[model samples]
Structure formats: structure tokens, C-alpha cells
Target: MATFPLEPVHDTFRAIATTVVPEAVALDRAGWERLEEIIAEALASRPERIHRQLRLFVRIVDWRARWRHRERFVDLDPLQRTRELERIERSRWLLLRRGLWGLRTLIFMGYYAQPAIQREIGYRARPEGWDAVRGAGR
Candidate 1:
């Protein structure tokens, strides 16, 4: 059977992604699915060690929720999820903090990579530069 390696943590990543970028919560089903596919494609080009580290970090976030709140990361309320992520972002350990920031960078990349979001934000980059985009503004 064909499979996506990122499938195992997609749900956990969904919660983490939405928590990192709250606006993502408003995305429709197709948009969300595309976001996952995009993220998977991005990760696919990276080395396997980075892949393993990121997947482990995702699981750690989920387990940390249960350890601290007696609930899974996805099962937590929005407020709780935000607070949990914020705490991790401010973690004292250098590696832990780095991991959170790296994960967040990926989150932003996946979210902003959406064409709709790019249009909403008025971002249009053309190889020909400003001259090409000028007409699009009119």
C-alpha cells in the first residue's frame, strides 16, 4: 500500500500547527489536507535525521500535554494548548527551545505557503520582479 511517512503524526501535527498558527484553524478541510501534503513535501527533501528529530519532537509535545494536564495534546482546550506551546517556547534548555522554534518555522512555512493565504496577505513574487507585480495590483 502507498503511504505517507508523515501520516503517523499528522493529527498531532495538526493540533501543533493550529496552535502555532491560530489562523490555520479556520482553513477548510481541503486547505488543511493540502497544508499537510505541503509540509510532507518540504520535509521529504531534508535528511532522515532531521525527519526523525522532528517526528520525535511532535510526539514529545503530545506526551507532555498528558503528563502535565492529564490529556492528550489534541484533546486539550485551545487555551491550554496555546499555554502549553508557549511554555515550551520559553524553555530553559537550549535544545528544547531550538526544537520548538524549528517546529514553529515549519508551521509558518506550511501556512504561508498556501496560495490563498498569500493572496490574502497581498504577497505576489514574480521572477521578473516589481514590474510584473505592478499590474496585478491594479
Candidate 2:
């Protein structure tokens, strides 16, 4: 069976997303499904190694949290999850830290790219910098 965010690490991945974006905690079931679709789309074009790394890193987070908090990351209190993620973000291994950063970037991209979120944030395209878009089909 597949996990919602991505399997074999979706529990931790979802926990991480909610920690990174507290607003996500309030998302409805359908909203979470949509966000997962968006996140999957972002990963679909990546190299296989990227996919493997993400799975590995997410699992590592779960294991580390278990060691530190005596519970699955998904089961930890929100503050504990956030602090654990912060510790990983400050890891001495550069690659490890960058992986978390990449994960965070992905979450932001998936969360903010939703049409409702874009509208809520008052995002709109401005074509003034390059006239090509303004004149297209004109």
C-alpha cells in the first residue's frame, strides 16, 4: 500500500510538512490529497537518486525522532516535531542540511502554488518587466 505523501516514508514526510507549514495542519482531507498531488508533480521529473534520497531522509527523520523522543515523528507533539526538524536542519553534514532545505522548498512550492493559496496571498502576474507577454497575440 502506498502512503499519502510518498511511500515508504509518508508518515514522516507528512509530519515534516505540517511542521514546516503549520497552516497545513488545518487542511481538509481533500486539501491534503491535492497538496500531495502537487508535491508528487514537483518530484516526478527528478532523477531516481533524488527520489531515493528523499525516501531515505524522511525515514531517517522518523528513526531519529524515535531515538530522541521515544515516539514516531508523526506521533510526537508539534513542538517536539518542529524542534527535531530544526536539529536536522542544523546538522553538521552539509548534504543532510541541504536535503532538509530542499524538502522545505518543495513543501512551500506545493502549498503556495495551489490556486486558492495564490489568491489568498494576493499573488498576480505583472508583465511590465518584459513586454513580450503583454504584446503576445495582440
Candidate 3:
């Protein structure tokens, strides 16, 4: 199983929240502390399944960014990026299909909260387009 770093996830959330709610970010430290408390309380009420979905969401974004900039950063052949994106999409679909409320929450968050991230990172090619690559199971 793959895991994502928590700080980056949190930072991403903060960035999204700040963009969506500028007043929240404009607050002083004490105000931000209270906002954090509220957000924590809300998240605590959700099931653990949400965390799994969140992890997948973060991973997909990270992978998509890498894939989009593959030429600039590393020597990922077209085949390699295709295989990796397929793996990530499979994981995301599985979580979306089988996980519980947490998964649902994650989907909702992704739908609403992910536009900026997706805009920044760009989208992967559709799975079918990637199917021609070896190791990207149809």
C-alpha cells in the first residue's frame, strides 16, 4: 500500500481553504487557532474511511503533477507515466466504489476543493488512452 505525507496534505487543505475563504486566512493566529479547532472537531465526527479517500485524492494529485511535468523533472518514458497513472486511477476508483462515508466525504471534497489543485497540476490522460502501455492493465 502507498501512503502520503500528512503535512503536504494539510498544507494543501490550508491553501484551498484560504482560497475559498480568504477571511479565514486573514485572521490572526488566535483566530486561526479557533478555526483549526472547529475544523478538527468536524473531521473527528467523520469516519476513518474518509482519511483513506483523502489519502488517495492527495496521491492522485501528486502523481498527476509529476506525470504532467515528467519531462522537466525525471526521465519517465511515456510508458512509465501511463502505468503509474493507471495504478493511481485504479486505487482512486476502488476507494470511491467500496469505501463508506469517509469515501463519500472525500469525493465531495475532491469535487469542491480540488479545482485549484487540478488546475495547477493538470489532468492525466483517460485510462483508455493509457491502456496501450505495457503494465497498465486494461
Question: Listing every candidate in turn, what is its Cα RMSD in Å to the true structure after a full C-alpha superposition?
Answer: 2.7, 4.0, 16.6
Give RMSD (Å) of candidate 1 vs. truth: 2.7
Residue range 16-121, candidate 2, lDDT tens digits: 9999999988778777777888878877777777888888888888889889888999999999988998898899988779889988998888788787877877
* lDDT ranking of the models: 1, 2, 3
- 11-96 per-residue lDDT for model 1 (tens digits): 88889989888899899988877777777787777787888888898899999999999999999999999999988988888787
- Provide backbone clash counts, one per model: 0, 0, 1
**Which candidate, 1 or 3, would have the higher TM-score against the true structure?**
1
lDDT of 2: 0.82
lDDT for 117 in candidate 3 is 36
Which model scores highest in lDDT?
1
| Residue 128 in candidate 1, Cα distance off native in Å | 3.8
Off by over 4 Å in 1: 1-5, 130-138
Candidate 1 lDDT (Cα, whole model)? 0.85
Model 3 clash number: 1
